[model samples]
Target: MTIIIMLVAALLPAVLLWLYVWKKDPQKEPTSWLVKATLLGVALCIPVAILEMGIETVLFGVDGGPTNLADTTIMAFFVAAIPEESFKLLALWLILRKNPFFDEHFDGIVYAVCIGLGFAAMENVLYVFNDEEWVTVAIGRALLAVPGHYAFAILMGFYFSIYRFVDKSPKIAVCILLVPVLAHGIYDSLAMSSIVDPSIGGISVLVLIYFCVKMHKVARKKLLALKEVDKCDNESSFT
Candidate 1:
């Protein structure tokens, strides 16, 4: 009963987001590949969790950790952002490595969003399913965390497309991994700091809202920009 509802709540955002990204692609990739990429994302969560635990052990020695802004930032970046985004990037590469459908710029973002939402869906289940404030947590994550992952994926895929078909330099290649980590890290750090200092919770929440809004706006523009580029290429090819 409760568990069923929780599962639905956790997954609803991912489903909506999946459709959103899928519809935005004018020339959709094969559904089979997207589903495979998404399942890889779900499977990658296991490795990502293990890697975060290992990093946490090395950083704080299996005990109390990240009591302040600086340490929290470290945990956010190393423990959370770096591990998760790096694995997703690796997964993206593996999915597209020999993919014949990797023909356009926007395909990158579409596939990346599928993988990201898969990861987010599993993660949302973990966070909201076990909590006592299940409804609140579910709603908050649907609004924030799920979208944050979507935005981060856009950043990764935006830069990935550039690296793959445009620049391919050391710089743009690095952005494929770097931009998401920075965005994810900053988001986590801002959100997590409140746990250490209740007094600053309000300020942190406000900042987090601004950050999420700003990040989504940037990611949205990038997604649309790539979509337009793909459309232009298609039009030019037909002429």
Candidate 2:
């Protein structure tokens, strides 16, 4: 009974976060794509999570602590960073990129964030059920992991928008996702590491805030450029 109560407490915050983000679309809301993307993100996380566990088993031993510096770097880079970023990218490509519904730069953020928040929601449920100290896990994920996922998605979508307009540089957008992945890995490493002081957690949170602001600026700039192009097109048509 006690364990069940703990799981409920942990799961509620994640569920609420998912619902809030899922409902946040203001215009031309994408209900079907959002559902599909979210489900796909959650599904991909399962295999990636399993692979991460296996890698940790061999590299960090069953206890999951690093055996050496190289192992530590690989664990952080591959298991934590690459898998998370790639899964979100896969969700975006699968749900939004090829769809006609993805008409604007803002849609990138919308669809990508929904998928990320979905992944976080499911990941949180798994942690909540498994962890004995479910309350702290729930609070930490609400305060940190969920926001981190949103922030990363925003970055992914932001660069993708840039790639769309800057004709010769499409592939660069994929590299841009690395920034968020690195930041995410750093945050995870800091929290997991015994070497660092707890106060530095603020730095990780600040990274998310920084990227959010940066992406907002980029989106605004892109929208303005698009508006200018549309105005030119309108004038040309009239002439």
Candidate 3:
């Protein structure tokens, strides 16, 4: 029963968010491609885990302490954010670089979000099941962490679409990879601060919530703007 609940809690948010993003696309991506991208995301976790472990060993010497601000920031940026987003970007490149269905701008969001949620799903499960307070952890993550991943992916996809379809510049490609890593790093840094100082941590959590909400709105606006561009292109082609 606990396992059942854990699976549901871990997976339900990702599934719901996936459908929501999929529906937002004016031209729906192929189901197979989305599924494949998601699975590749899960597969990429293995390498990410290995990299994270190696990084932690090198940086911390050992685990299991209340992290200081400097340690937390370093862990967040270099240990967590850089490696995770870099690999996700690589997965997106590998899966969709030459795919036939990646014609529209919004396809970037769809594919990137699929990969993000796939990573989130596997990640959520591990965190939830390993903790003693699984329910509390699961609920908190559902609200903040999972949606946070979605926002990061949307940002990545937004820049990636511009890079791929509009400008095709090397700089934009760099933005596609770096922007999300910065965002994810900040988010994790704030969340981890609570361990060292609860008062600061409390303030950071509120700020993080606001940041996530703002990012969500920005991502939605970008998606709508891209859809409008697609509509104009389609209408022009018809005439």
Candidate 4:
């Protein structure tokens, strides 16, 4: 029963967030396509895990987390944000470039979010399994970490749609990968700093709280904007 609870705690956030983003899409992609995107995220865990660990070992030493602000920032940006978002963007591109269902501005957001949540669900479970105080870890992750991924996904997909349907130039194209990497790096740096430097941990937590609230609000607005964009696209089609 404890295991069951832990599993639920680990996964529920992803499911809820995925559903929230899916609901925001005016023209929902088929369920199977969405599932494929999600499963692709799950599938990506193997490669992402290996790459992250290898980078950390080579760059920072074996299993050694950040020791200071600089270390934390480096690990966050390189080990966590860059590779994760790159793989996600690559997956999004490979899957959706030729997809018929990926027709609207919002579809990018939907598929990207589905993939993010899928990765979050499995990653959360891994965290719970490894931690001694899994209840705390699970609860903390469900509240913050999973949502962080959700926010990053929204950022990625927002730019992804623009890059895909609006402009394909090198500048606009990079935003799909760059925006999410920056956001994820910032969030991870802040969060990791709290752990690495307990002296200012309180300050770090306060800032994280502020950042998360602001980020979620922005993510919501972006999704709402996508809905409006779909409406505009539809109206233009008939006119």
The best candidate by lDDT is 1
lDDT of 3 by residue, 120-186 (tens): 9899988998999999999999999999889899889888888888998889988998889988999
Candidate 3 wrongly placed segments (more than 4 Å): 64-66
Which candidate should be chosen as best, given TM-score against the real structure? Answer: 1
What is the total number of backbone clashes in candidate 2?
Answer: 0
Better of 2 and 4 by lDDT: 4
CA shift of 151, model 3, Å: 0.9
Clashing pairs in 2: none
lDDT of 2 by residue, 1-239 (tens): 98677656655654565565445433445678777877887787788898788867876678766644345456777777787888778778778657887765556666776777777778878887888777788787777677667666666766665566454364676555776677667656544443233454576456545654564465445434544554665579799
lDDT tens per residue, model 1, 106-190: 9899889989999999999899877999999999999899999999999999999998888989999889999999999999999
After superposition, candidate 2 runs with Cα above 4 Å error: 1-24, 62-64, 67-74, 165-171, 195-239
TM-score of 1: 0.98
TM-score attained by model 2? 0.73
Where does model 1 exceed 4 Å of error? Answer: none
